[model samples]
Target: MLDDFMTRATLAGIGVAFAAAPLGSFVVWRRMAYFGDATAHAAILGVALALALELSIFAGAMAVALAMALTVSALSGRGYAMDTLLGVLAHSALAFGLVAVSFLSGIRIDLMAYLFGDILAVSRGDLGVIWSGAALVVGLIGWRWSRLLTSTLSPDMAHAAGINPRHEQLILTLALAITVAVAIKVVGVLLIAAMLIVPAAAARPLARTPEAMALIAAGIGAASALVGLRAAYVLDTPAGPSIVCVAATAFALTGLYSVARKAR
Candidate 1:
């Protein structure tokens, strides 16, 4: 069954959707969209690091993403504006990664694959890694759901309840890094934030509770992945961007629905 590349790709997409669901919901609630982008952009640097050190791409991406997320978390509220800091780091990381990749003269790397993903080419091992990482992310978020939610809704309340908001933020940072590392193969660094944000945003209009939003987002994400892959195959388009396009469409539809509901 897994012998089919398409089957592997489908499973991989679903796995990623599940992982993105809870974390993405938190990201939306916290307004951490740019933070997600910054962490994802840093993955390119991880790619360069992996290539340089002969390490697993996943490991390298995870390391650099974690480092970037941590750096931003640490530097936040320290005189430098959040958006400005992220802007500088995000662009710098991408530029450095691109230049570093160019320096690897002996290696013939398809940088497009890293930037835009090659989901159809996912191997069985890759599928395993995706699923494993997905499971870990899901479990981690599940364990911290209540605390994270408390922190997001009100840091003061969380502190009163003895749940350190900063610790919860760190958990999210760690999870975000893992998601970026695993998602690189599905949507690439350039579009990973779309995968994280679009589905959640799409679900926001339709869901009343946080849990419902996450579930709906997961369903939407899975649908987008499957539909996007099918559309990509049929239209001969790039799979990664195709997936993001589908998610964007969902976002638009949901936004329209929200506006129409408000008018009613």
Candidate 2:
């Protein structure tokens, strides 16, 4: 029974890793880590809405993330700094979510679990949602990889080449929303952004191309999930944080190696 439980947890973790790694590569490349954090912080509001309306957590998170992305995209055109806007929205939404959760009197919800995640509690149905969302995200990214690369490398160049940077941005934002929704369940709102950034960061120094970076990020993420799960099991620690620690460790090691190579 214990073995079966661990197997399911591990599988779920792997799914999260696969989904997070590729998307995280984009996040790192675009310097959208703060945007990711903003979207993820808003997920708590989605959780509250889900509980209030009896909707699925995944659906609620996706809805909120999509709304947040749209809001940010629209606001980006208003001449305000993007980081400032993201900071306001992220913290404000998190505060509001906390207040909303406090309003529910009867049920005792573990806010920490939602904030930091409880991956061991993931159900088979949740796994289905994670995989389906992951497939959609990966397929969309793959289909537009060239365009995305063009836009990321140089918006002016992409525009000169007739690719619509705005449209690509929208597509990437949508994909990010889906990713945040799917990942929130695995790593929770507070830590979801880490899952999206850490593995990609770790892979950056080792990659020579955008595609190589993404693939390596995915491999690192998958390995982190497995290693993190093992650590959690042995140390009786929380799964999500343990997984993040592994990713961070990898990032540190990669950074050191890069520095050494540069010095040589």
Per-model clash counts, in order, read 0, 0
Instruction: Give the whole-model CA lDDT for all candidates, comma-separated.
Output: 0.94, 0.88
List where candidate 2 sits over 4 angstroms from the true fold: 1-3
Worst 10 residues of 2 by lDDT: 1-10
Where does model 1 exceed 4 Å of error?
Answer: none
Candidate 2 residue lDDT tens string, 1-264: 324767777777778778887788888989999998999999899989888888988888889988998899889959889999999999999999999999877777899989998888877777788889888999999999999889989999999999998899898888888988888867889998998999999999999988899889988888898999999999999999999999999999999999999999
The candidate scoring highest on lDDT is: 1
Clashing pairs in 2: none
lDDT of 1: 0.94
